[model samples]
Target: MDHIIEAIASALNISVKQIKNTLGLLEEGNTVPFIARYRKEVTGGLDEEQIRVIQENYAYQVNLEKRKEDVLRLIEQQGKLTDEIKADVMKAEKLSQVEDIYRPYQQKRKTRATDAIAKGLKPLAEWILTLPRTADIEAEAKKYINDKVETMEDALQGAKDIIAEMASDDAQVRSRIRNSMEKYGHLVTKAKKKHTDEKKVYKMYYEYSERVSSLANHRIMAIDRGEKEKVLNVSIDFDEEYIINWTINKFTKKRTSPVNYLIDEAVKDGLKRLAFPSVEREIRNELSEKAHEASIEVFSMNLERLLLQPPMKNKMVLGFDPAFRTGCKLAVIDHTGKMIDVSVIYPHQPNAKVKESQRIMLDLLKKYPIDIIAIGNGTASRESEAFVAKLIKDYNLNVSYTIVSEAGASVYSASKLAREEFPDLHVEQRSAISIARRIQDPLSELIKIDPQSIGVGQYQHDLPQARLKERLDFVVSKAVNRVGVNVNMASAELLKNISGLNASCAKNIVAYREEHGEIHNRKELKKVPKIGAKAFEQAAGFLRIEDGDEMLDRTSIHPESYDLAKKILKELDIKEEEMGSASAADKVKEASVKKLCETLEADSYTVKDILDSIAAPLRDYRDQYAQPMLRSDVLELSDLHIGQQLEGVVRNVVDFGAFVDIGLHEDGLVHISKMSKQRVSHPSELVAVGDIVKVWVYNIDEEKQKVQLSFLQP
Candidate 1:
């Protein structure tokens, strides 16, 4: 445990005390969000990300230690364990390193070396290593002749095989070669001879070669996908001769030895036949793992940003899911996201009921007072947008429209949760509702769908599913807890994401609410099934009741600190009803945190948190982000010209650039090179998914309906 603590502290550059305390809390079954929010003093004020890193590092260290112990036990059972081997095992930081150390002693299948040993040629193989200066190696090999060895040549070949296998098993040799390959190797990919790529999706990779160390993670994922699809063949290209010669020199003791040629042959054979393939696999796996981690991090960050996009509060939105054959599903939702009306409009080809569609839309708009139309960016989206723009212009209606990414709307519509929410509605109708609701409250609606289906990631399907799911789940939980769920209005999906709550518990809470009535206070949560004392302790701070019995329940102040809160209120001469009022804020501003801590016998973190919560009870963290960009006008591909400046919301950020929805059918691309005059390591550093930025048209591919945008003026 001490070793794990020290290792995590050293790796993360955190204090040993912080790591130890955080680990203790985690071991006590405290969720990362709970500890980060409520136990700030115990963790030295570490944020959610930092606490999660400590948890991940601690788990990794524990797993590595267990592996080391297992490896040591296995080696000891074989009576091959030495002080040096034990030391090496103990010092190994990664599982791969430990495996490499244990590879030589691990039981093997029928191999050339094992066959030679079974045939009683082990002594000859050992003798050859001495590199006898004047000894005749062929004569020495004859001494080991047996039923398994027919001739002197056979004996010598067996001995050479054993020596080669031994050389391949040498951990030091494998490590050196692996390191050299990683530093100097190139990943070379080529088009498969028989494969046809009509789309040219992987054209750039047909004859591509890049240094392994310098390759971008997106490129690696792309190449991997291409190879998986059989469009490309990939291999690692390294200086094999240099490695072979280095291995030979490391093993050769005397240049003048008569058996030096045999040792040289064995070393070459061993490296080419055994070591190269094994090391190449290790290198590729390592590179793939790194690429997956980088991609997952990018995906997780993008997902978090998308989830936290500011809601279009208090707006009556019309969801427009556009399609040709199915017409377009339109759902009008009220300010609170309840579906008020549902209709279909065919404003495009085939039916092309332009007049009738406009009448239906006008009637709904007039009836519901729709403020904005959330157009789904799917088939016929631009056509639908044009229709909406023309209707608004023709009728002079007081409404606007914006394109929304409908990446996962279909998936969410068909989900069991969606069915439960809208059992009588069709899938498309449910999708329309989801679209409108997502625009109104993205965090609430988006949480209902799987994060991967949100389509904010790159090569999400190609990455390890379990790892991706784990990361995305954590990101969702972090975002949900950061925003604080409203106990009364939150769906089971949102409630499940709250700290210390699971699907079953969230469902139970909802059931309890349905069976009885609205939970008026935090104490009422105890009456809900599956919510125990520990669960309540971890979740209470993040669960808010907007108009509950206890005033502190309306704020983020934990119930455990209610007494202290009241004492502080009394000390400051503030009434319980004054929370979130201007007078309460003013008084909190004038109070000294240090003096309050001393007077109240409380920690500074607790006092400051309570005071801040009191000043602005139930603050929506999402309010800090920019609201979704609304547009009354629409643009066509033909309307775009170079150097035209336009404001667009960044739709998706990837490794190469950001896609900006410039009110066109196709989102414009702002490549990394054009993102800034200064170097940008990643697109996220410059812009996120929801940022509305001003960009100019650098170029336009009208044929492709693609617009190239740049941050700088052309």
Candidate 2:
């Protein structure tokens, strides 16, 4: 345990006390979120993410200790546990180092070493690693030469092969090799356009490749897209000499032998055959996993912000899923997000009469009292937006329309839930309805579907299946937990994602609530087995039980906290009856914080986190970004005769260009050609997702809805 703590402290650059405290909190049934948020005094104020890192390192340290113990046991059983070996074992900090030290003593099944030992050449390989410059080294090999040493070319070659295998497989050598490869190897990828399909999605990646060391998250994803479609080949590379230095340094530093010449050649063969490919793959995979995690984190953060973005609220919205072949699917969603009505019109159908469809939309707009018409900005989307624009202007309707992201709406339409929700509706209609509902309540509706289907992650499908499932499940759980669930309406799938509420626990919570009445107070949750105080602690803040027995009960305020809150209410001369909705609850919360601060007698740093966590205490403890918007407006796609001033949103940033949404349903291209006024090699230098900027509409293609935009104007 002490060794594990030391290693964790070394790896993470934190004190042993911090690691021990974090582990203590973890052991005491506190979650990372709880320990990080509620136990600030216990953990010395480590944030959740920092605590998570400590937790990960602690686990790694534990595994390292177990591996060390296992190595000692295995060597002891082999009867090689000499006093010296026992002493060496005591000093091993990590599993890899222990494995390296135990390399020669480990049991073997027929390898080059076993073969060499059988051929009476075991000492020769040892001599080579020792680097002894004896003049009769060739003579020593001559004595062991034989038919089994098949092809100098015979004995020398056999000894060299055995030594290379031993050196390459030496855990120390491999670790060093891996480290060197990661530190020096360049991730290389290239276009394989010869086998490409123009019909495939992500055609932009047909000619892309970049080094892993310098690759950003978006670039890695782009290369992954290319490789996924068989349009690119990727690999990691580094200078051969660099790999040699790492292995030789470990070998000479550890061994007493003078085997420089032999070890050097052996390293070449070892790396060329084993270490290079394996280490390179590890480096690439680690990089990919890191990038994937970052991408998912960003997506999760963005989705959380988008979900919490004020809903258009009780206002009916018109959603348009536009297309050329099947026309458009339009749905009117009332404030409650029930599909009040749906219609199919042919405004974009090339062979149809456009004027007739225009009248249909105008009539619906006036009838529904719509607040916003969310147009799916996909193929034929701009034309449909144009059609809707003319309708709003012609009818003199007061409704506003905003383009909606239909990134994975099509995938949702084909899903079983979509099929069940709108059994009789056409696929296009299902998609349109989804488009509308996403705008209505993104978190509520999105929780019902798969995250990968939302198109925010990188290589989500290509990820290792088990790893992907674990990570995606984590993301879903965090999202569900962050946005609080309605006990009555949540699907089992959505319910299962609540923190500490697995499939079975979620089912029981629902079952218990259903079998009885609604959960009057969170204390009733104890009736469900395995949902003791611990589970409730993690799950309560994120679950909403509307109109519960207590005024604070319906909100995020934990029941354990009700007494303190009641005292505050009495002190403020306020009744529980008066503190119910958003405003009243907010004031009561502020008063409670003041009282709690006085009670705890701690610094704001200590008391603030706890107070903020006393159920929605009026402030969202979780992070939230500001809503994205354009700085300026582009009135028309064609108004840019050459250089027209426009405002745009940085929708998607890439190495090539920043795709900016400038009022058009289609996001225009700000090709790397015009990302900034300064010399820009990469678009990310001056912009990123959600940057609102003034850009010049450089080129307009009315036929394609592809307007080229630039940061600099002529």
Per-model C-alpha RMSD: 1.5, 5.6
Residue-level lDDT of model 2, residues 511-531, one tens digit each, is: 886788677766677788678
Please give the CA lDDT of all the candidate structures.
Answer: 0.90, 0.67
Which candidate has the top score in TM-score?
1
lDDT of 1 by residue, 473-576 (tens): 99999999998988998989899999989999899989988888889999999988899999999999889998879888888889999999999999888999
Q: lDDT, candidate 2, residue 243?
A: 62
**Model 1 TM-score, 2 decimals:** 0.97
